[model samples]
Target: MNANNIVDATTRSPARVDEVLDRFFSLSTTRAATLAPAYEALWKTLRSNTNGGKRFRPRMVMTAYEGLGGEDLAAAAHVGASFELLHTALIVHDDVIDRDFVRRGIPNVSGSYRDIAHTAGLSIPTAEHRGMSVAVIAGDLALTGAFRLMGLAETNSATRARLLNILDDAVFASAAGELIDVDFSLYSGVPSVEEIVDMERLKTAVYSFEAPLQAGAVLAGAPESVISALGKFGREIGIAYQIVDDLLGVFGDEHATGKTTIGDIREGKRTTLIAYASTRPEWSAISHLVGKSSLTPAEAQIVRTELEACGAKDFTERLAGEHADRAVAALADGNVPQRLVDELTPIVAAVLERVR
Candidate 1:
């Protein structure tokens, strides 16, 4: 298929995943209502949290499944939706860890609950605690909801088992990656570029890209060799995707990306961009500005200027392109089908499309 056809196909996959999620939420909402009104409110909040996502994980699953001529789209849909739920779970927990109250320019689950607590006349500290507690419970629900969706897949025993294994690996690797990421942020020493790259791969590549692609192949009953190839492709592109996202976090137009450009710099996120910048002389001038919760927009702008002049931005861009190239090379080396390859190659370009 051509690129347009591939885009159309992947676009349809989100609709399929949405169908599955709708059914799951419908049932959950009813059950929660039976439990208590507050329980029902949590489910409503969760359903809202899961909305407006890019649905990238589900698209990856469907891409591989359909590309390989998989017949069971229903099974694939359920599997794809599971990853989306997993994505939600991780981000919800991450917000709690970061103590971030906003997401996508609005109040997140924690923030919403905190606002509710405030309206209820709770003290600031108590409200904050309540928000965090509710958010933790909400994230747990999403995490378990992911596995529940997986179990709803229509596939037989053997295929279901394999898919579950892939999901398990994704979850395990992502949790480790998240822990290491938090550790890196807290540690005094600067992490190596290689280490950050590994962390990125583990945190995002496995679940967001690799597992979804691999699971789709398993659903299609693809050979082990092909599954391995797709996983590699997913890893390379996933890393590139994240690196570019880091770039966007610093330099891209917040209005265009719908994410804060200053948040990463303020949080002292140990990204590949920051890692490369730290080796430069300009870093000394701006190092103190980082991680300042009260960092002003003007100060953040200075940090951005230093990062650009120090060549960190250009170096990181080149690194992202190199990884994208490697992803293409994997397809060539692995003898992935021409149709599968053609569809997948465009995705590599799409990964870097934002920062450009």
Candidate 2:
């Protein structure tokens, strides 16, 4: 379970994961058709979205399981698929909340419905409603599918319960985090830097990284200490991932990320970057520019200039590095096998370097 071997294990999971997911979707297709023609159409788009994104979450589960010496890859793959489905469900709801029409360069769940409505010559307002409705239903469907998939994992009743409990906790935490995120944006004053980090952990860290690793560890019969240690490491790395994501939201090439560079600023999304910049006096002049749904390109550029001048960019980058260091140190402190350490190195790199 060295780094190379970890990579090898992960490399083999893609096809196996896809194979299981394909079956899952086929079942969905039949179920959706039974629901209605629109449901059938939604299932097709869900399948498309499933095929589009890289299955990193599930990979985390499988690698951790195999790294810990779990020989039952079939069961591991099922759990891995469950995590990916959970992600898919959440993202669909997320898009509805943000009114985001696209993800990874294509129409998101709501956006797909929006596109369909547009093709059918619906009015803008009607189309928007349709989009939101479809996305919500789609998200619910995916969430239920995720739960069912986890229930089917080839493990004992006790282990199955543990896995489901982990998934349930993660879903609860993620929902709370999303709610907090909305509330944070509505705060009268700028949130503290600590708030952003805390939100990052609750929102993105636990389920995306920690839950997957813990789920795998549990199935592999790893001790509670190992599971707890992996959880901490996931938290640190998850925070780093968010920091880099915030950076990319503002500065990375839209062509690469398939997101509008100005979206975060325009949406007035609260992030650590904003918290850091708010400490400076110059923030008052440009503060009004952010959060405007109709923000112009020139205004976005102006805001960007001020953010850079106030040193927020540099501060965010430095702080992200510190978090990455902490994550690595936590992994060491966990005293996990060297193989687990090696298995997780890319996750650390992805967060710190923002490559994947």
Candidate 3:
């Protein structure tokens, strides 16, 4: 596909991604009859997550594949589904850890189970346990399903092996990053800007961008130069994406973003903004309120006000812009087709706008 063709395909991002997911659902539905009833419920949760979002990871895969000269649309679709499934699993697991009961304005996987328990008149403790259990199982199912989908892609064995290797490393690195995130949250001292950037690259960038891009390039038989360039693009963009996400988590309106402004503050997420603010003398005034489970809107607004007052917000924006520039530079070095580059050009801007 030429770059113009790729641009045309971008317009169908939702329909194409959903079409890929629908095929998987059809097969899963047939298999559901042979599985335990609980498994079916979990599948429903997976379906919910799959149906929402812009399917950013899958878009990355398809765009990279087509950009690299792969022509088999069906092959791309199946591969796209695999990445989507992996992302869904990650979100489910993240929700479980954050104790978030809702996503996309609906009860999340765990929240669905919690609702069921609530309907059954279970106590809060029991309901919460049921919710957590279901979310864990649901996440596991999605994670395994992702690999299975990858295996089912219509590709050569050698190609699949390479893709799997890339994916496995991404998953491992992402997990290590997650563990570090938990540790960072528990520390009394604020994490440094460098540490925060490094953590975001590992925790949010790898599987989210790097693995999918590398896998796509590998499937397309692209050269190591292209694959390496895509890796750099993914890493830079992914960290930028995460940093913008952190900004939104604290400053964005819930109605517009579908994310709670107070959640990160309540969880004490170790974002660069918080780290920068910590260096300010005002840290002593609001440090205790950051991780408080009872963090109110008033308290969250105070943090936001201070984040802006301390110049952390601008610092974060500058950092994100710097990485975005690096991402574009990486793409420029890839010998990437102009049209392909054209298709990807908007991603950096879109990510920046996420803070709104």
Top of the candidates by lDDT = 1
Lowest lDDT sum, 10 consecutive residues, model 1, at 1-10
Top-TM-score candidate index: 1
The per-residue C-alpha lDDT of model 3 at residue 335 equals 79
Listed in order, each prediction's TM-score against the native is 0.95, 0.92, 0.91
User: For each candidate, what is the lDDT?
Assistant: 0.87, 0.83, 0.80
lDDT of 2 by residue, 70-180 (tens): 999889888988998999999889889888888866788888888889889998889988998988988988899899999999999999999999999999999988988
**Candidate 1 lDDT:** 0.87
Residues 110-200, candidate 1, lDDT per residue (tens digit)? 9989989999999988897888899999999999999999988999899999898999999999999999999998976678788999999
lDDT score for candidate 3 against the true structure:
0.80
For candidate 3, list the clashing residue pairs, or say none: none
By TM-score rank, best first, the candidates go 1, 2, 3
- Model 3: per-residue lDDT, tens digit, 204-225? 7999888888888888888888
